[model samples]
Target chain A: MVSTQARNALAALAATAGMAAFVAGCGTTSDGSDSASSGSGGCKAVSIAYLGAKTGDSANLGLNMVGGVKVAIDDYNKAHPDCKVTEKDFDSQGDPEKATPLATQIINDSSIVGVVGPGFSGESDATGKAFSEAGLVTISASATNPALTTNGWKTFHRVLGNDDTQAPADAKYITDTLKAKKVFVVDDASDYGKGLATGVKKSLGSLVGGTDEIQQKQTDFGPTVTKIKASGADTVFYGGYYAEAGLIAKQLRAAGYKGYFVSGDGSLDPGFVKAAGSTGAEDARLSCPCGPASADFTTKYKADNNGKEPGTYSAEAYDAAKVLLDGIAAGKTTRPDELAFVNSYDQPGLTKQIKFTPTGEVTDAVVYAYTVKDGKIGDATVIK
Target chain B: MQFFFDHFFELTITGLALGSIYALVALGYTMVYGVLQLINFAHSEVFMYGTFAVIWVFTAFGAGGHTSTGGIIGLLIVSVFAAMLVSGGIALLIERVAYRPLLKRNSPKLVALISAIGASFALSETMGLRDRITGFVGLDKPLADYVNGARDNSSLPVEITPKAVFKIGDYSVTTIDLLVIITALVMMVFLDRFVRRSRAGRGMRAVAQNPEAAALMGVNAVRVRQITFLLGGMMAGVAATLYMIRIGTTRFDAGFILGVKAFTAAVMGGIGNLRGALLGGLVLGVAENWGSAIIGTQWKDVVAFILLVVILLFRPTGLLGESLGRARA
Candidate 1:
């Protein structure tokens, strides 16, 4: 009835409206993914990256750390709509081979401003060079190798105590308080294991004069136990993760060495108890850069997890995310220049007040020792 | 002399018992390699998956939790059979999805190797990814609960208490250790009989000797290959059941390193030899334990590799030497 031009114009308008409606429907999600930032002036979406072991042997640890970061992001977004941050996570899998590629990917991404981790110290080294080259500000919740901060990687930071501090403290404890002389040492041959063992050996050497080295993943300690007995060593220091440690402890007791057994944080897991059983596990001392079981964090974490156990490193992960968010708010802009807001992280974190030296290592961190009693880690001694 | 007298039998017995388990897992690798010269890198994962299957089925059917000796034995039998079936099916699927397409395309042998590695990665990640996704949906806890409930119900009468010990004269052995050893020996006997007596096993060996010749003789090489995978996987499933009984809990990546070691055992015994697998596994286990005993436990894995290299260097055909097929270049 009307002119063709008028009809065509109406149709065009209706089609435009339909497309708009479809886009609006697709973009709006009930999930927190679509929530707007709550800042006074809604900031552009900020992309934060988290890197850790996700798929390989250490995937469990990696998954837990990332889980904590996600919780922090969700909580932060809910609290501050203006702090609109989109989180991206990549798994390094505690493998140097994987870490190099993953770090390159994270560095190449222009949207990443701050990073939560590459969980292990060994992995941190693998990716630290790439990150530093890009001027990216990174904080690790668990990387403890002292050598990580040595190569002058300006952007690297860790919230946990370095092996340098922890190992010496551990050696001192075994030799002085425990008065355990003639110690035999074992390491996983990993950066963490070797470094900590070296540190312990240096201190123990000062007291007991020398030490012995063991290979990683060994199930039988009979030869070592024999040697320990021969050397009159009353203490065995193990610098490895839980798997081999548990096996070694079982064999050591079985061999009747009648010596004290000591190890680092890697041996602190409940699985150690399960593997070694009760008698062998008891009286075994373990050292960890202590983080008190956070009642508040645990309560919230349990609630989120429906009362199941949270992963070991989740608290550190949450704290890492919090530090990054603080950095983001201080930066005043969400653009991906990593150093733009580095100064904003000057504030204290949940576990400790983080202050990075020229090389990004924490200047003040503490380690503590615990004795295994009744299939759990317990004790109240801080090693200085 | 006193110390040697006290611990000699204990160490040797312990070594032999542990060696039995290595033998059980090694048979899977040897059988498949005998037929297909392919490593079946996913074999360990098949073992791991079998364990989860046992856990899942035993739990799902309400066989888990505290049980008497008879109840425990019942659960063990059912679990072993369930694991065998599931693992066999998974092996078939892996071949169908990853290997068959490559074979049909006439891809290079290297491609098959890469595909096997990829398949291993894919299977491991699948479980891990499922866990992550479930966590996001708040379903992880509930799932864990379901699995835990089953585990609790299917528990054996030899209770897992810290103080639990089994007395044998002056020496004491843990219930866990005793169970692991007994189960491993039984599996070895079953596998030995199955390979020597079964009609399907002969078909497998014929295909292994010469696939083209077997095909010409109307032996359906494809069917033989499938059966080999099934048998190999069934062996792995049994091994997994033994492993779970010893290890207590399972993880997605649990088989990664252990699988590599088992494969190394296969190679150590001479790739295509069945009896060689058993011998090689026991030797490797004893060697590993002794290496750790001599040099500290930390060196155990490295020692295993060293032993492999040394054996390959001197006796290129392996300790048991080659029995069938061409020696590896």
Candidate 2:
């Protein structure tokens, strides 16, 4: 396991070139959790930590969250350079096993007052209890497994709806919008994928033709495709991230399924279209709980990051990070105070209106249905 | 059970295609093992580089778009040659850098094994971190298309999507299946002829049987070893090209699992035997697909190894006895 202090010191030095004083200050506060210099509107080098996949198979998805967090940090730093908070990356690689040890190391750091993400569902489930026990605030931008909230982690909060909200809406879109009579459900057998598939299966009770489970990195979908084609399903609904989902979509089209393909938020990125090919991805419906990005925010985000478009939950991540930054700006520099401030956070964000249930579920969610046209996932229109 | 029987033919054909990839890649493992009596773990990186060569050559040709059949054929020939060149070069370099030093030092076989594993990691990271490497040399922007997405999947979507050529029962059979299987067979036949009838093949066999004796007989043991690695690398190049055509995407780490499967195929076929690789690959592929169809698609990964275990239990020397030294010459 990587020591958080070492990673942070190295990153701080490389990123700033002159954070020796801040590094020394953080060292002094490493123990006795309450050792940080507090009680002022201006913070003393307290930072926001990003816990997500910086590298791995789902890295493309996790990177969008990193982009959002980066934007928030830039905005905050620009507004107040006097108290510039650093952002350290703890790359969990979206694997629960990797995330658990990283989570332990993260809680041991006194400088990281809040966390922006534990991106995927499984990683969130693995790291949530540690953050809660340490009284550290964590707001996930994308993890949608519904069972997450049932764990009773007080510091846990989400900017997007759970799988229960998104999956039912996705099923409705598949049935009403596409008018599909038979739907074959497939999951990557992940916590997020299985949970979402269960909801879709329940909602599309009679319409489901068959269901199958696929492994995460297993590329050959030949047997599953054979089964789906044999079942005579009109539409194939995949519950997985873009990495696998896009390949599944491509293989299905190649096998002459010739039916509509549907997926949830996990497949909403440009990578999906690239994976499925321009023509293969045409007319594929993607249901996401992420509200449409405001034009101003989109333009700003693009300019901020090499003209690359925001991915599925980038907007929600931007909002989640801003919420934590706002808490710090308002004098909540410690973990407990930051948690309290986020617990009562209620404001309109770039993505949606932010308010949470007592159980940490977002008060309401609006799912948007997006379709691929000419190899591009077009702008979203409200579906639920 | 009924689904397995009904779709068995379809599963078998596609399985054969997937197995062809394993067979071609397995030849690399079996050949190197035959010559050096060392598992060339870094051979997977040789395969991966060849896939990138295919992608890069195509990307540079017509900006990755060609509609006409002639254009596609021209692209295919040029890309395959490019893949073979790149893969063959990397294989030679690995021989020089990773294995040759250890061999010269008369190091323990375990030390050479560690060197091969280290070479595997080094080669994998070099490809994975290509963007940074190119950037460090101030060529990132100039070489954006190649170096970009250093770690993510480099998807090469089919421009001319393959059409179904025929129907086997209810399943539509496509050209990709035929192309992959036929290519593997051609390469295998060519390799077999080269190993059996050619002078260099005779030298290789002599070296494998007894390197010191072959050296005394003026066989040039080092040259024979180099030829073995070169042949294996070219075969890996063929496998890489087929994989790109069928899978339509490649990542830095793409070779790991496929390499494991191919190695398993080689072991199942008796590690040093040539023909055994093809047989083991086809069997494993068909068994896994059938296993998925019966138990569930989720069990597909374990099915191959489980079958291997069962087969190994019965035939420890593998389906065919291990023999490159004892080939019926």
lDDT of 2: 0.82
TM-score of each model, paired residue for residue? 0.67, 0.84
DockQ of 1: 0.18
lDDT of 1 by residue, A261-298 (tens): 89988787776765665656778998887464467776
Query: CAPRI band of model 2?
Result: medium
Residue A155 in candidate 1 has what lDDT? 80
Looking at candidate 2 chain A, the ten consecutive residues that score lowest on lDDT are A1-10
lDDT of 2 by residue, B1-329 (tens): 88888888889898889998998999889888888899999988999999999889877774443347777767778888899999899899899999998898899999999999999999999999899899999999999988898877887634547678888887678988988999999999999889999999989888888999988999987788889999999999989998888877788988898889999999898787888887888887788788889999988878889989988999997888677767742
Task: Give the per-residue lDDT of model 2 (tens digit) for A1-384.
Answer: 111222332232222212332364355455323423543443476788888776554666677888888888889989986677777777766667666776776788778899988876777888899888999999999877778899989988999877678878988888888899999999988766787888899999999999999987677889998999889999989888777888888888888879999998777778788778887788898888887677877787888888987776789889999999999999898999999999898998887788888878788677888889888888687875
